[model samples]
Target chain A: MQNKLHYEFEHQAMATQFSIQIVGEEYEDAETASMLCFQRLDALELVLSRFVPDSDISRINRMKSGDELLLDFETWDVLKKAIAIHQKTDGAFDIGVAEYVDVFRATKQGILSDFEMVNALQSVFKKAQNASIYVDPETPKIYCVQEGMTFDLGAIGKGFALDQLSELLEELSIKNYVINAGNSSVLAKGVSKNASCWSFPISSAREEFAVQLNNSAVSATGTFFQGDHIFDPRIGQNICNSMYERVWVSSQSAALSDAYSTACFLLEKEQFNELLQNNSEIAWIAISENGKIQFFTQKNIPLAQYLIS
Target chain B: MLAGTGLVLANPFTASASVLSANDKVNVAIVGCGGRGSGMIFNNIPKIPSANLVAVCDIVESRREKARDRFYTLFDKKIKAYENFYEMLEKENLDAVVLATPDFWHMQHSVDAMEAGLHVYCEKAMSNKLEDAKKMAQVMKKTGKLLQIGRQRRSNDRYRFTHQILLEREKMFGRLTHAMGQWNRSKIWTMKPNKQDKIDISKLKQYGFDTVDQVYNWRNYTKLGGGVVSDLGSHQIDIFNWFLGSYPHTIYATGNNSYFNFEQADTMATILEYDTPNGPAIGIYENISNSRAIGVYERFIGDNGAFIISEGKDNKIYRESRVKSDVWQKYIDAGYISNMADMKKYKAKQSGDSGIMETAPQISYNINEMRDMDKVYNLPAHTAHLYNFIESVRGEETLNYDAETSYKSEVCIYKIHEAINAGGAKVTIDPLEYIV
Candidate 1:
């Protein structure tokens, strides 16, 4: 293990940051592999960065009011996944919320009048029904039957990145590693310097470092910074901030962990508990609004069990 | 006279003003004083001057006692404890509200605090989801309230410095063609089920039950929280947008509940594409649930050179100076190497940890680049950002990371999730989409 070539690379992505640690047999080979992984990630960003003007997504957004745009491979791919999650969660999770929400944002910035914003958002909602979106996996084409339709992927992009990074790492034959998009979404394959499983502290201690971690998925989606900013697009109202407010999902893939955490956060109690019952592997600890920290898991594992075991 | 509790700084912007004047103190009240609320109490108290903990509110009496005791022990401050957050807000007359509540309650508490004419320092990921984020922003605007998001990175120096260097410079990072970041964790393990006898069992399906598992562990389920992406990814993705100069044009993602068979995906990956005026850039990100082989805390790659950043850790830059590489040998022979070298040599450089802590040195172009205070500051941009925000509020300078700039990151992260949900397809990131 000591002789094994392990290289670590760090990049600022998502909003937080990322640290990628890869271990292989040769140092030069590992560094090259890390570089390759970084390059692949770069390619992924080119096709997707919203800041770019000519990007496929940006072009679509820049399309004139009546213009019809052809969807790119990556855009179409995101549309398909959105539909699946929306369907799976019975629309509990929907990217369509962006259409209504952006108008609200403009209004707050004084770019749009309140009435204009409302009317504009209502127009979008009305057109939403007319908007026909279809993705053909064969040709990988995403077509919008209605010109008014728009797609948003704020919920699951990190997961997709994780999957891509994982495949890239695997392709590089780099076996023991982890790629984290910001401590929230991550892909981990092996243990760390410590022999024990990586332990993530659930308390709101604000420590910059992790406690103990090795070969496990941990994600905490707590409304720590922005208050009830996550509005349900279905209804342009803020959802109730629950006592059990943070959703930490642990799974095999960081993508899954990130996605499920988002999905679960959107789900109600019956749906959430039902999913937990069916899937016993994931466990969550939430800090209640009442200052009580509760634990919900498929099993009866206590916080103490993980903390002190 | 700032006649409220928690008025720690005279003003973050105007450094000329004495922040720790013996008479100037910030009187604050902690709502939902649990782990996070208490943690915030500890985290900020030491940084600010004379921040008196005026009150503590918690639904649980015992928890309130624990907080009060801790506050007393930590700062020798007597805290008035309460059972209801609303009651505390109505009566406390605090300078600010530290809303350390759950995802669902953040909106209400923040709105209430703002309406009460108090400054609010809320925690990260903003609200649980997009709607909540918007509402919170709206309320802040309407109230003209000093709403400081708990995204400490907004206050940290490391993150801000990178944004300045990569963005403000003349394509200094060389068109920032590609970027990738990740957060890897070991086994987060499991939280034990709350004892069944504590409360109503049927309420587990409700939106706001106070059960141990339901309230404290509500984030594990959906309705109560926005999952890990909204919770954790929001922060990092926000940084991505800030440094990249805009939102992601396209995004694609996927995840599974393989490890923690919860309703949500425990682990996931995202691919974000940025469309520059020149061409395109890409960002690849990831989050894992089960394993903990943490690596590459943060990396920003560009056409000319790349930068690697970490919090409280050294941020290093590695130039793609291998101009004579196999693929680039032809270009090198064609005179691209000389121009590249000249550009690289002239770029302003400030490699280390931007005066936060001694780390590695940052390499950039020449003295011209050094003029921009942002790059000179480098990562840990949060410190400057906080100071800026306070300064803006205190009539010092404008808050650079206002709703608009902050929204850029929001829109980008949302686009990434949207793109990935489409099975790694592309999607428009512009805000002017034809409605829904």
Candidate 2:
């Protein structure tokens, strides 16, 4: 027997699986809303996916120096958030490290020889030094003043998609729902019939916990999920000596939770403590490499207040 | 309208239409504020620099208003909204209209727009009924206006390059013997009733829908759509007729209304037999509403090589092992195609391999035009299709998939529907039937 009488639907987009659960809605209505949401997601993928040749991101990647391209509004929205996160994290989270990330990934997959890997890294570092991309604040336009940079939204794309879906759900009058993007970023709204909040099991190297979510989002990133592919873009190197094994960010917005979870993972313990102090509303959980656990939150924060095993 | 040609024009808005001068922006309106219509309003139309979306029309008042408000918020431009098509036609000063409504409405909306001295980019399968689709082409001929059917692949740079440069020019896929395609979906779309819908049920009947579900999930209903065959198969079948350079001489199909169990809808698997200039060939297509296995793409195979192309991810060209690698070196050097990998050449000088010898990967190549175009996302095929229509309106470029050519593809699609509906029967099509 199930505790909730909700409908669940799954879709694939942004190269990841996504699932939506609608609570207390009629099946016909839930299915319809999900289908529409998936369609919107597909459209977003077309505009956002780098693999999509004519997508705004791909066009931006291929732009010459001093080239400007009008962007799809959705891409513009994502870039706006990404720029904010990049600034707030003070270079810890950067989308411009796509070249370096690609080299590291290829090296990890055994596709690059030792000599080729060093040369590739050196080449990307030189390119990064000379490249800077900007988004138009007033319109959906991206300008590449010194082009030769690529961007991959794999870090925050699904979270951004969840936030967009949440808007659509609100338009559809679907108030009570839980939506997840491949279980990495999840947004919960309202309360289900049987439970006061939605709960998802989360883990790191050792510590296991579940966060109860209501009208909020939880995003986690670590070796458990990201598999050491996480790179510190500021230094042009990997996070070889990280204080934490896994970290989760709980925010009212999925895009924030997702992007910052990564930023938080890359941040040192002191830097994260400072970030927490600056953003009082954001709560976090960290599982250390040695299996120690920590929670940073307020007294009544949903994540801390409703923490479960 | 035409200097007193003894015919009264149906449009009350304008007299005779003048050709848009070079560099003149096209005033456009989109009718049918449904899913596809919303896509055009939100995604495609906004991307085209030469298009000015001035108005929108839908039978559902809320949908029309929502589309208008959303378009304004996203693009920072206000557009008028109308619940009736004729009112939008009469009030809005427009050069063209995009018909993204249900398949049943494509013909009527297209004919009305053409009659109103406006170019049209109508979504395809053209119409639910063959006669209606044929009538739409006839109206285009009568109006002498441009009609670009939404077989968007026809305008895709990859598909165009594959057909025109590779297959036709370089003979990449030599002596084309067979082609196959599939459009598989996990489930048929079923939309929920709008919670904020304010329209009266009586008014819904005026839009060719009995209930709101029919309006929302039109493809599942017989009266509003032609089910899986026409809805999904049409796009791929059009490619078969196009890339093969001829319409199918005969079609055989099998399908069942087992899943979803909608009144008259069915899952279809069809085989279209064609006689091409190269030789006789078979084009196989299947549209399954229940399983999304293999995704959506079209594949064409020949003696020399084979290639698969789609608006989605599948884009690859394979060389036959029986053919010498030197035969393709010229193409690679000319930037026609690039070798994906040359393992045989790499292994000739490299170290030894593992004991287990796996299946050798297909020596594949990718078309270069597609590659270069893929490097930039400025002119997606859908946007290019609309651009082609607007450019044609300005006399800059002719229509790529004109009404008559699209009508020919429809003749083949409708025959597949007929063959399936008749329980796997083989339907022969006279080549004259495709002449419109």
Candidate 3:
């Protein structure tokens, strides 16, 4: 019953709560754009959901043999972006560990022999070596020759979804909006009611905060708070247990931030700094298991921007 | 004549394929079974429409098996996998291929894919070698294929929006003159060869590396990956080109591997000169590895203000303007002002020209501050690159930031590297050389 043309909306999707602030002349348009974002996200979930056994991705997994496989454009887009990050990170940040991840689950559940599970995990990693796949830009075809090669987009799916939602909002001519998925990944389109850039604390408990956005993108990464379920396929261990418990990254895109934060957590301080040096828009706040928070900022942001006062 | 083998457009002047009225489903392929390839397959999962996962290729059987199993367990999507990129490219009737292989493999894979009648979205730096960069451009022209370098920033709305503001907006910076960009980093993990390994280490010997760790961490070394300069500098330096409105005329550079002790320069500083249509310009780009001192950032200094951009962080503006003082008055009287009346004739000039002494308002803004103006000015025309790519496939608007625009950014990056190598020697760039 709000009479204002602009409105704020939030929902839970992709295992994270996402919210959008839409401002436009027509209230319905803002709401419609916000509504479309959720609908699109739901549609994306239908294809990418790991839990959906009959999803498009699941169908590809069930295929026995095919030289050329067709997918919904959404699925193809996610796969292409994931492939790009996988190559850039050099396998440090991989989504192909679904098998090992599943095996890791099976071993924990006592459903498989520990030795057999180890062998299976090793096999998965072994076959992962020669998986050369490409997405053709002309016909928009996805091609793969190696048998047993599957693509997963977990790490970057939410970012892509956010990007889609942002596009929908823009098409509706909605500006002055902020898209936040959980507390980790966010995209801000315009300034808030206040003249200041959209600002948020790295943590609610601490007064120290970072500028969440400036008509750019921001993404946060950490293992699920409740458990150590997120596993690194690289060494077959829980990433949360091995490295910083929580890492938050602010960038120009939620996808890059999401990727960098996850990748940075796996890297030592030095590698993270090197990454920061390369991408100037990335500002970071990392909290290790010991409850130590390290703050990093690039040249573009001044110390004052993050200050609430 | 045909460019090569990819596109068979009835008209090449427009470059854009004829629009399809209804949403069109594009079939896509994934090349390389490694992390990047698989990652790309998954990330774009929800955006485009009517895409086929069709194929996956990798050299190793084990890696392919893992991919297949994961696809089944996660999405149950069945895909054909192959060992060789060529076999897959030849066999798969793909419209596009996302080349997510290692940097060294980009040029060959892209050329082959184009010749095989597929468009390409190859990963960054355009090529691992300088020769490959030129060859990639040539192959694209010959094949008439759509080639998008993996410099995703070109597709980013924020960058597009900002670049537009810097280039088209008047009174934005009021004649930008100087700028600086830095990619400072800390130490990176140097992988050591494991004594006992599961994978073959023999291939490592061919590359002069002892083990898989060295191969995996090739970015830290020089042989396979483009050290920090190419790996990181290419991105930020590309930003310099985007903001400066033109490529530099001269460049100079100095670098050291003091921290990483790697073969190539890990830390480097470069200077570039650009002559804007309006005025002369200069920029400094620094890539540091020892410490994340300034992190990564770019600063655009103009006569009236400065713009700051950083990845993952906020884009900000710090304001500064010319201040009038007694020294300024004397300088203005002496000869600084080209069209000035005699200083000896006017005592008011000795004190201060009240008009010249006025302080201009601060000229700076963050993305948030521009909404009111954005709506009024209708700025940021290129903010819809992604949607455009999607719609173009769906027969909506034509694709913006095509191969030519992307190549423009790469040309600037390559010139920076060349300049750095020549001790920051100034190099003139002919824009036509990069345009197909």
Best by lDDT: 2
Choose 1 or 3, whichever is better by DockQ.
Answer: 3
User: Arrange candidates by lDDT, highest first: which order?
Assistant: 2, 3, 1
Per-residue lDDT for A93-210 in model 2, tens only? 6677666765665444444444455676666656676666666666566666666568888788888899999999999999889999988899999886677778877664567777
Which candidate model has the greater lDDT, 1 or 3?
A: 3
Number of the top DockQ candidate: 2
* DockQ score, prediction 2: 0.26
CA deviation > 4 Å runs, candidate 3:
A1-309, B1-23, B33-35, B60-68, B191-198, B201-214, B220-223, B319-364, B369-403, B406-436
Measured against the true structure, the TM-scores of the candidates, in listed sequence, are 0.47, 0.89, 0.48
Candidate 2 whole-model C-alpha lDDT, 0 to 1: 0.77
Instruction: Give the alpha-carbon lDDT of every model.
Output: 0.55, 0.77, 0.59
Worst 10 residues of 3 chain B by lDDT: B1-10
